[model samples]
Target: MILLDDVHKTFGSVHAVRGVTFEVPPGQIVGLLGPNGAGKTTTIRMSVGYFMPDRGRVVIDGHDTRESPEAARSRIGYMPEATPLYPEMRVADYLDFRGRLFAMDRSSRREATARVMDRCDLTQVAHRRIGVLSKGFRQRVGLAAALLHDPPVLVLDEPTNGLDPAQIREVRGLVKELAAKRTMLISSHILSEVERLCDRLIVVSGGRVRGDGTPERLAAAASQEREYVLEARFDTDESARGFEAAVASLSGVASCSSSEPLDGAWRRFRVSARADGADLRESLAAAARARDIPVRELHALTPSLERAFHALADAGEEANP
Candidate 1:
């Protein structure tokens, strides 16, 4: 439903987006993730027709953003990071005014306002002034405004920002419910939220897309090092030292570090190996048997989405620098 084809944007000396291209198919929820200075906001602005791309083009539902800015924008409902709302207006009044901007007739505006207020859980505060509403309610008002036009594409930038845990979950559930019928592109700094909400992720950094795939695929691809933890009880200090040395000397092991003795005689060790290394559990088991050490625990930690995000961002910075 949305496409950015080789899109590039620049401001004076700073290049904000470079050759950024992605497509969000119908009924899909895609997450846009990146570090602080990455071009996520720029890409979003261009995609929504808020900013014109210096090169390439943005297309919304087959309408060229440059040539048909109105048609393109009419297909999208955008809620920015800091939602702009009038504190003096009542929740229903604000939504009605937004519908007016879309040239919705009085009857249509009333219907849309009522529908969105219910959808966004703003019906209870319909008569309350926006200024007196809590942060969560104000956010719901912003979301209700965005939905007033019933656009097919929803571009939400940090939809859950600044909300408490409960509020975040509430908004998250609402977004999930909305995604069933429309295409969505959400930008968020929260990796866990993205993992839970999005069907796919587009990781951007240094003005370009560094990674794009399902969360599991990206995490696995970025895991270039494998880590394992082993706990064992040793007969003497010399035996523990010897075990550490033996594990570190193994052909595939990159590094191994041990923790202070837990309890009295049980020591924990963390081992790291290259991505291509054989499973270290077997090697460690063999080493423990050779030393007659009693193994307490041995396990490998799984790669996580946060690790993948950082690794991709690091790669982008290195490439750009």
Candidate 2:
């Protein structure tokens, strides 16, 4: 529902975004992830018409943000990292004000405000002043205002930034609930949360898209080869040497390196192999059996999204350096 096509932005000599591009499909939650100064917020601002891109287009639905900003923005509900709110206003009052800004009629405003208050679980606190509410409640108020118009898309920047554990979980649940009805583009620094919440990820660094895919796909792209950890015990040092040689000779086995010894007779090793969808464990076990080596542990080591994110970010830095 949202598309950023080769978007570029600059402030003085600093290029905040450089040909960054991605799309958020309908009813999908996409995470915009990156380190500091990676242009995530800038991209989000462009998407919501808060800032115009210097080059390329930010399109929402079928409207171009640069050519029809108002129409494009009308379809989006935006919750910025630092929420702008009237401290003295009650939560319900603030939502009413937001509705009026969208030109919602008095009847429509009341209905929208009531729906969002309940949707965001802010019904009990609707009568409380925003100034006296906890950070989490204030955040809920901001979200309710964003949803007052019932837009088809939501752009959320750091939706769980400063909340306590309980508050964070609450917010996460709310986001997930909202996603069932709207396309969402969420930008977060919390890798684990993104891993759990996002269906796809766009990893940016140095104002460029370094990686884009599902978490599993990105991990696979970052890993050049499949790896396994093998631990085995041998009756003699000579037997261990023979076992290593046999494993190294197996088909698809790229390389084998000895790790720290498990004890005097048992040793741990890392086996690297081409990721060709082949089962190398059976081969390794058979080699050990032929060599009379007793197996202690053998398992494939799965790649992690955290590692893939850092690897792509590091690659981006090196390319631009």
> What lDDT is reached at residue 142 by model 2?
82
Candidate 1: where are CA atoms >4 Å away?
none
Question: For each candidate, what is the lDDT?
Answer: 0.91, 0.88
| Model 2 TM-score, 2 decimals | 0.89
Candidate 2 residues lying further than 4 Å off, grouped into runs, are: 234-267, 274-279
In candidate 1, residue 11 scores what lDDT? 96
Error at 264, model 1, angstroms: 3.5
TM-score winner: 1
Each prediction's TM-score versus the true structure: 0.94, 0.89
Scored by lDDT, the top model is: 1
For candidate 1, write residues 24-60 as lDDT tens digits: 9878999999998789999999989999999999999
